[model samples]
Target: MKKFHRDASTLVLTLISVLLLTVSALICLKALGPHGEPMPSVTDWISAVGQAVGALLTGGALIYAARTYSKQRQDRHEELEQKRQEQAGKIIVRVKHGLPDDRTSVSLTNPTNLPIFKMNLYTIDDDGQVIEGQPLSEEVVVGDYPGHAYTQRYRVHSAYAVFTDSGGVAWIRTSKGTLFE
Candidate 1:
């Protein structure tokens, strides 16, 4: 739809340009002489027309360049925004060691417009044993809101998280790397 509108506008501009050029040429011919009495030279008429249209051509080129630059900037901005949203939606797991107790946190951020549902997290031991973990709540819908988090207080060790979204797609994440759905 937008492309159609842009093409239509370009066609209209081309037609207007042609009309303006024709009118200017006719005016130049009339100025030379109506009955061909003491008519100006052909070179003189051509020079006059070129001088008249020079400023209009310059202005049109400038306008086209400005529009192209604006469009490129807008496209770049939209691409960056998409990347930021993807980065924001990833599952982040962190472990904080304190004097009294070490706490591990599992969080899934939803930067998209759709709300996420039924997210769960799990803990992994040094022996690669999966232990039952907990979430801030069961079946929480998270979106632009603060969302939900699961935290456990234990000695800081190797751990990861697992969850399934409303789409029934499972996701796994660890502190080192390899976090995806």
Candidate 2:
């Protein structure tokens, strides 16, 4: 909307400038002649002024088009970045309750085709403090397919996972479904 307003103002200003120039040229021609008769070389002067105004309008149009294209390209780039960030968030961490005989488990799943590196899953309390689990010593790559699971004996309040995406961007995803870089 702001871009629209700016473009509109620019067009209005250009038109006003052209109108003033044309009126000024007509006034000059009138003042140089007697009894409102067009002076000698009047047609030549008008022709020159017309060419200058045409060039000015053409230049303004080209500049406006270039700026509009640049803005559209930038908007597309930002949209793609946002989509990438959302895809990175698809790395899921969940605490699963198993059968009566089975132990509680924490699983890290990477649904995306891209592999995530240095994945670390943690069980956190209500206060967001890490209550259980340790960071993996080696960088683990979690790919698409069956997820990696850990048998967690302790009851979990919540869970979160930290990992680097295929694009080398780091992200943190909570069990509550919040994701951020």
Candidate 3:
């Protein structure tokens, strides 16, 4: 001990010994960390952080792409629907005329008159039950008319008719079906 204290290398040697003791204590404490210490492993912690960042970026990109695609598809669908409606006659209103002569009834044709859905007319009156009528002049007219296909696409929601030289127009036609039912 006297040689150590008096030696020229005394300070250097003491410092080396102290460093060695500190390193050994650190090793023991680290080795004991797994026994309920919850000390995270370096490799596992690094990988978990990387995966979370990757997942967040990927999810955000997917959501953006889905919304963009949906909006594009909706715009295209609306354009096509409008074009189709232009070629078809859109019904706005219909009025029926009660003729004194049952056979002499005439319909004032509206360019926007929608083609009928079913063959039945909805109203009845005192003079006679308003008979079921179709817009087509005749079965032959339906087959030969260039506009027959255009006529079939739309449906009328409601109408009123009066007996006269001419019948009234159709109202509120839509290619879209009633959503309520």
Candidate 4:
């Protein structure tokens, strides 16, 4: 839809420029007589108008090119951001129940090829209290499974994992599997 709008506007601008050029050409022709005689001061005015039209066309072309370059750059940036988000989403947080000692286990799985740093995993109870919390200073590599991080036997309502991805973007993942930066 945006591309359609841009093309429409560009077409309109081109049409307007063509109309202006045609009008100027007709005016210059009218300034000349049937015997090919020039009118006083009319030739100079026509030359100035021609120069102005050329400048207008050049400026328009430059503006169009700049806009195209800017749009392409923006598209590339968006594509890179989407790829980063997919990589971050690969970090999964799961809460396992029914341990041998009746304690809930909070497991973090990083399946991506890159590692995550400054990891903090927290298990929250029904009353929004933190049941167990584990903070890892070192980076968690790919396929590094930190299983049974929560040692408490409390009933966990949800779990949260906060860490920085390989791209240096911080993300928060919940037990419900929602991820965001």
lDDT of each: 0.54, 0.66, 0.37, 0.72
lDDT of 4 by residue, 1-181 (tens): 7567666666676676666666656665554534656554866667767766775676577557656755786698789989989877888888887766667777788888788887877777878887644443345656655655444547677788888888899999888999978
Q: Which stretches of candidate 3 lie over 4 Å from their true place?
A: 1-38, 41-43, 89-181
List TM-score per model, in order: 0.38, 0.66, 0.31, 0.65
Q: Which stretches of candidate 1 lie over 4 Å from their true place?
A: 41-47, 50-52, 55-108, 111-181
Clashing pairs in 4: none
What ranges in model 4 sit over 4 Å off?
Answer: 1-53, 99-103, 136-138, 149-152
Per-structure clash totals for the candidates: 0, 0, 16, 0
Worst 10 residues of 4 by lDDT: 132-141
* Maximum-lDDT candidate: 4
lDDT comparing candidate 1 with the true structure: 0.54
Residues 52-152 of candidate 3 have per-residue lDDT tens digits of: 55544555554555456556766787887565454223322233233243222222233433333322223222333433443333221111122221121
Ranking of all predicted structures according to TM-score, beginning with the best and ending with the worst: 2, 4, 1, 3
Q: Give candidate 2 misplaced runs (Cα > 4 Å).
A: 1-42, 125-128, 136-138, 144-153
Better of 1 and 2 by lDDT: 2
TM-score of 1: 0.38
Evaluate model 4: give its lDDT: 0.72
Least lDDT summed over 10 consecutive residues: which range in candidate 2? 144-153
